[model samples]
Target: MDEVAAAIADPVRRHILTMLRDESLSAGDIATRFAISRPAVSRHLRVLRESGLVRDELVGRKRIYRLDPGPLAPLAEWLAGLAGGDRWERRLDALETEIYRTRRERRARGPVEHRREHTA
Candidate 1:
């Protein structure tokens, strides 16, 4: 899927799209959720917006972002051509959720030590 390949080229943008799919979020909100700077987050948002996976509108002074599934329709249909696209999607979704949750848990602990103290 060329769209999938294009959409997944940048990890940050992919994460931003995933987050927006779950719920509409402002630029600042997305920046807060990511470890990167606000400008970096904005750049990722720009990519998502350009890719047609997300749309944003100015709500007063704030820009609210939402997932635009219309563009992803083709990608979905292409994926459906596979033997188990639906099942594969479900499994991938579960894995992604688990990974995100685990990362949040560990990040909450502050600068993670590469080496854990173990008693021999």
Candidate 2:
């Protein structure tokens, strides 16, 4: 999971994953989409492969890469846990209630008292 997160932390690698999500692409095809060198793209692919986010198959002389998506399950679950159950809505409702309570208390206090200070 750490490796998956690390691999996904790179913008280039994330883009690569998106590229491979719908369909597999040859290494050369993937490299051509980026301005970087083939070797550099290959290195990114290697990191993704090691992270289990991607899988590669050699088709004839070309290597085809595709998104694995299996390793991402843990990350997705962790994110969902972070989101909690209706956490945002509950927090907002609590805040609104507090605001209304404060307003009601202020209203119950009636008018503010003003005291004049005498010069020493």
Candidate 3:
């Protein structure tokens, strides 16, 4: 669990996971999408690969990465399994409700005004 948490804590790594959520990407392709240095991207990928959240295959000298949902399944199940599977579900519900409320409030607020009033 600690390993999974640590891996997910990196924002770039999270974005990498997002990129690979439904499709695989080449190493070069992944590097180009982010503003970070290629070496930095490689390092991040290395950490993610080690964390078991991603897998890579070498094809014709180019390495391709894909999300491996298998390892993450255990984490999801563990969270859901806590408190007999109700805790995680309740937390998810709370999050969804909060998101809906926030959207509603934002829509109510409408556009923002940036002018500052002059003080005498």
Best by TM-score: 2
The per-model lDDT (C-alpha) reads: 0.81, 0.91, 0.87
* Ten contiguous residues minimizing lDDT sum, candidate 1: 111-120
Across 19-84, the per-residue lDDT of candidate 3 in tens digits comes to 999789999999999998999999999988998999999999899999987777777888768746
Tens digits of lDDT, candidate 2, 2-117: 88999999999999999998899999999999999999999999999999999999999999998999999999889878888678888999999999998787677664521122
lDDT of 1 by residue, 1-120 (tens): 475458768888878878887899988898999888999888878877877788999998999999887877777787677668788899999999999998897777655442342321
Order by lDDT, highest first: 2, 3, 1
Per-residue lDDT, model 1, residue 31, is 94
Per-model TM values vs. the true structure: 0.61, 0.71, 0.65
- Prediction 1 global C-alpha lDDT: 0.81
TM-score (C-alpha) between model 3 and the true structure: 0.65
lDDT of 2: 0.91
Better of 1 and 2 by TM-score: 2
Q: Which residue pairs come into collision in candidate 2?
A: none
